[model samples]
Target chain A: MGIGSDMYRQQILDHYKNPRNYGELEDADIEHVGENPMCGDTIKMFVRLDDDEETIEYVSFVGDGCAISQASASMLSNELQGRSLEAVRGMDRDDIIDMLGVELSPMRIKCAVLAEKVAQDGIKIHDGELDVEETTTE
Target chain B: MSQQAETLDVERIREEFPILEREFDGTQLVYLDNAATTQTPEPVVETITDYYRNYNANVHRGIHQLSQEASIAYEEAHDRVAEFIGADGREEVIFTKNTTESMNLVAYAWGLNELGPGDEVVLTEMEHHASLVTWQQIAKRTGAECKYIPITDEGRLDMEAAKELVTDDTEMVSVVHVSNTLGTINPVSELADIAHDHDAYITVDAAQSVPNRPVDVTEIDADFLAFSGHKMAGPTGIGVLYGKQHILEEMEPYLYGGDMILKVTFEDSKWNELPWKYEAGTPIICQGIALAAACDYLDDIGMERIERHEAELAAYAYERLTEEDDVEVYGPPADDRGGLVAFNLEGVHAHDLSSILNDSAVAIRAGDHCTQPLHDVLGTAASARASFYIYNTKDEIDRLVEAVHDARQLFA
Candidate 1:
């Protein structure tokens, strides 16, 4: 496969094969779930916040989906372990694509952003500022 | 393969579908997405364009000659389609937008009016969302309980489970005749018998079966049968919903407008006759004619031979796909399947597989196939499906195998 191919990039396959921070955290402070209704791909993100209440202490996730979705979740959870929740929630689609290290077709873009979304959703739920039902990101 | 060729002139059949001759990239297009929608042959296409060129007018409302001709053509479609499905008469066929609309018509028009809190509407897990979600919504509306007859490991409907599921509490049973995802052909006649024993009506979502197999509404003793026109070589925007005459008479109309009313007053309106009562407004005028043409085309080719041809294709495809390493195929045994195979290769997302296949000029469907619960049961988010049709060939199936091989080498 060509390196330039948006779908078969080395970084994507790497994360897909060896997804980091997979499984659930027992003492998680925030847990949120998100689903792609059209594809039936679901991801549940778990996060334990630091004493500061903003920085991520530890994070994990569990889900079954396409490489973009699974790999994107793995990479996102791993990246968030040392970052602040505000920094991640402030991230736009471009930031998530940058984290993915691969370009995505418009249709697959949601897969790349799903993890970022669930993390944000988790933070919102932790703060009691969001409705779990209303905020289940598509 | 040779035996299949003898029964169907594959080359001649391929020529009739204009899109079959086109090339994608450097490779000729090998379309196997027939379960989604079949490529319309030239005759059906011509029938549509011919209607627009010759008789362009609103049906039933106008008193002019154009309306008369359009009305005649549209009603002829009713006769041809009714005969094709073995309905009692032309009055049994009501034209709708697609099979989804037909299902909704039954749910809103019949289920809402007839069902109640204690009623149980039996369904199968193998149903597409068009069949499942409608009943689910109806259940929510009428306070009925929606029960499903789960599929066996081989993906066929569990008849043993079905026997237990359709009991006295069951009020109506809606099931898919041929599963779009699993490729299982359900025995509707048997299911209908069980439902009737409980004083329940059965509705068959024949979206996948009607175009590929021989369907007889009379033989199946169906209360309602629904199938889309586009899946059977006809134009889009038209579908057929066949209900037994008396049952349709009992149910109310779905949409209200121009042609469906017998008499209209400022206060209220009286509905029209049997099939017309169900069809409101100026329907898919040209599409109805084209669907009739499609029915005629399938008839001339002989449906039994078509069934044999597709069964052979499914068997061949299942074998070829299974031969590849890292691939997992889902569905019943070859003989029991209708005309498709759903599969996914290890380490490759079904969508990724679809994109990879597209590079080699092959077309296949990749998604949940609108059966999310089944996908949940299969423990996958989605799967790839390659469904066969009359014009598809063995070489094309080989191309599909090669594409999967490429995907395995790259992704797996």
Candidate 2:
């Protein structure tokens, strides 16, 4: 990799190339789709809750987007396993940026955090706090 | 190289734009985003500074010396744009915020009133959202049906489809003169003939065409034309809309306020004359003046020379990019395109490509380029665009190619 191009570190490229948990959960109790209208990066997140209905049993996503966005989804999916819905909902922009380990511009921040948004919105939709046709990370 | 390209002194032209000398670290800035906006030259910047320093007054407002100077220069800017586009002086030119507003001015003032339930508005699949959305909303409001002219496999406007679509029911035919995403130089003049044959008025979105080449509204028989100033080396927040005098006079004003009013009562008002009637409140006086300087700068170099320079650069970039492995360049063959090239690198997203290229100080645009439907047609979510201008060189494109090569390897 070229110097000064740390944004595409090997870790990010690895996750982007072989995304972990990169598929849909057919039995997902909570599913939501989000899109970054700026770059047309879309992520549809699927989360299945355990019998307690609080802990995430499994999480996966399927969509087309840039490396930052898709890798973000992959990394976030791995992190979301066994986490409670409350924990996923509590996740914010800083957590995603911290996980990426890169200084993201405001535009890239939207791409980096799109998966988190979809997961949170899916929880919100399940709880009946928000109503919308589709969630978007504007 | 073509004769016109040979006549252009690119080195001398590069001197006018000090921004070209900018460096990211030790690497010199290779600006390939001219399709988004061009770098402002010293002349246009000086004009803007001079207006603010010496004649910072509202035009057509005060009788003072500064106001008079501002008014005259601002009015002359309209005439300059008129001459630039081969239109009649001042009478047909109206300054709006940008090309989007200029298009809305037409869609609202003409389309809203002229179009009805059965009327059709024929646009192309390659239209920028500025034209497509404005007309789409207008069609929704007016109950007019919007039809699209499809594109050919070569990424050019299907003239046959356009001819078939623009029937007697078509009231307005608006298309971009150059596809900003594909760099396809559409056959607008022929499309104008078709629109006219069916008694439909045609509008040309010259946002891409006006900056890169010699575009004559008269030669194309365009009833209306729109272009932004910033895309041509002027300041932002200023754009030009040129319409036929008769049509402009017959239509009601799109906006209404102080400057656009000749007389106003509590319940009634008489709108101002042709151009002023459309310019509502206090206008972009300084920007309008500076845009004239941009026109002057382009004229001094001769637009034909600039066009040839960009054409050659685009063709070269296309050739070089196609030489790269798994690089899919969009648009027609280089001979039939404008100054831009949009492409995709296999297994690399456009945004990722843009970021990687940025590390090498090679700037390019990455996104849908405001042509989402067009991207759908291209079957890609987004593409990277490298656009050229008068100051860009083959050497810069070489740097871009080398950077892309590095990016591909890095991704691999």
Candidate 3:
């Protein structure tokens, strides 16, 4: 049986149908792209750093995937709009699924967290803390 | 219902497969992913169990009783596979790990030796990555150019394009006998004829064809054919690569080990006969024996009956899928295709539809079906496929239709 009807709540459906902060970003401080090759879900996250360079000034995402991936990216974009770069690294798969108010199957875990991966990757690249080879994957 | 039961006997056939009796989430499992791999029958399972329990010995190595028994059984497996597909003889069949390995065995052993720079290798866009990627690697290694035969919008092979593609420079023309993604049954016999006209050898990836339909290597006139055992009510890790005896005799051995060598020393070694030269090491002994049992099981049921049953189910699924306004079906009409229906619902991703379908205990395959080129051609990222088998019933189709409605309600 399915996990629960709670997974497909109207709010989650709303985010998927009318995604928030959707589209590419120009003059972005950090841009990261990620994909779950298994299902061909491609997600890109762009973060514009505020003048202080500690907090996220604006966040935008672009992706083509299942509802869970798209909705998670949409909902997460709103959460990261003004958060610090520190909070982005602290976020994991559970936090994303928890925010969605649903449980994701193991096979779909990659989809729900692809946006968060891109955001954190963007943070690492922005700080110049990540190796170029490492940033190329995950 | 009772009248139609006489023709299919699905209930009786279901009993042969123990997995069909299983339940998921308090509901009977409706397995619609037969095209990926068919569930093994009790007889095939028992045959494998008997092999290990009774005669568990490495074939062609020992002169002991267990070795003799294992060798006999394994040889019988080759004989059964040969007869199953109307191969010239037992020597034509070579056991490999799976269909992928079978395809690679030809690419490495045959294609690498024959194809070179300035040569063209013709393939269909509808090939699974197993068949397509190997040719790509061959092209890279041999400096051969790989060309594709275009598929029509409706998923049928465009013969006109194929005529242009398979020119005199083409040395090998490889194609899938049946497309795993779009369910289109290709005209391989005619393709083989075209390849022969160009003086090129043809290889048929029959992994999707031999299971549900009657396939004869002789009738198709294929120089090489490959199919997996798991897809035909047998075990995994057991596959067959059938080549014309003369072609196999001339090709270099793909692997080197004890069983494949007639005489080995520090200086040099001579290879064994036609089939054994390709099968290195101990090989999949038990799975091969069970594969013979699977062939026997299919023979008892009759390939013609299975083909008819699958065609009917495919037609029904197509009819039901087309009735929904939001569903855009893929592949040719049921009469022209095999026993599978692939489609996409409006605003529903294939994975999402499959996740929801699982709630109803209906199993299906979602995603590109390993034909990324075909998926790109179809303008769909992924599609949901429901493939039928001998054990599938109309009741399962009804449940699948209901599951689609539920998916549409949730997503669309």
- The TM-score leader among the candidates is 2
Question: lDDT, candidate 3, residue B178?
Answer: 86
Off by over 4 Å in 1: A1-5, A21-30, A37-40, A46-62, A77-85, A98-103, A132-135, B1-6
| Candidate 3 local lDDT, B1-412, one digit each (tens) | 3546336677888889888878877888899999899999999989988888899998887899999999999988899899999997789999998999999999999889998999999999899999899999999999999999998888889999999999999999999998888889999999999999999999999998999889999999999999999999999899999999999998999988878888888999999986889988888889998999999999888888888899899999999999999999998986777899999998888888888888888999998888887888888778899999999998899999999999888876
Docking class of 2: medium
lDDT for every model? Answer: 0.88, 0.91, 0.88
Q: Candidate 3 chain B: minimum summed lDDT over ten consecutive residues — where? A: B1-10
For DockQ, candidate 2 versus 3, the one ahead is 2
Better of 2 and 3 by lDDT: 2
Query: Native contact fraction of candidate 1?
Result: 0.42
Q: Ranking by DockQ, best first? A: 2, 3, 1
True-vs-predicted CA distance for residue B264, candidate 1, Å: 1.5
Clash tally for model 1: 0
Q: What overall lDDT, based on C-alpha atoms, would model 1 receive against the true structure?
A: 0.88
lDDT of 1 by residue, B1-412 (tens): 4665448888889889889877855578899999989999888888888889988899887899999999999988999999999998888999999999999999999999989998999999988899899999989989999999998898989999999999999989999999999899899999999999999999999999999889999999999999999999988899989999999988888889878999999999999997899888778889999999999999999898899899999999998888876889999987779899999998787987887787787889999999988888888879999999999988999999999888787775
Q: Write one digit per residue (lDDT tens) for candidate 2, span B260-360.
A: 99999999999898799999999999999999999999999889888888989999999999998799999999777899999999988999999999999
Q: Any runs in candidate 3 off by more than 4 Å, and if so which?
A: A4-6, A129-138, B1-6
True lDDT of residue A46, candidate 2: 88
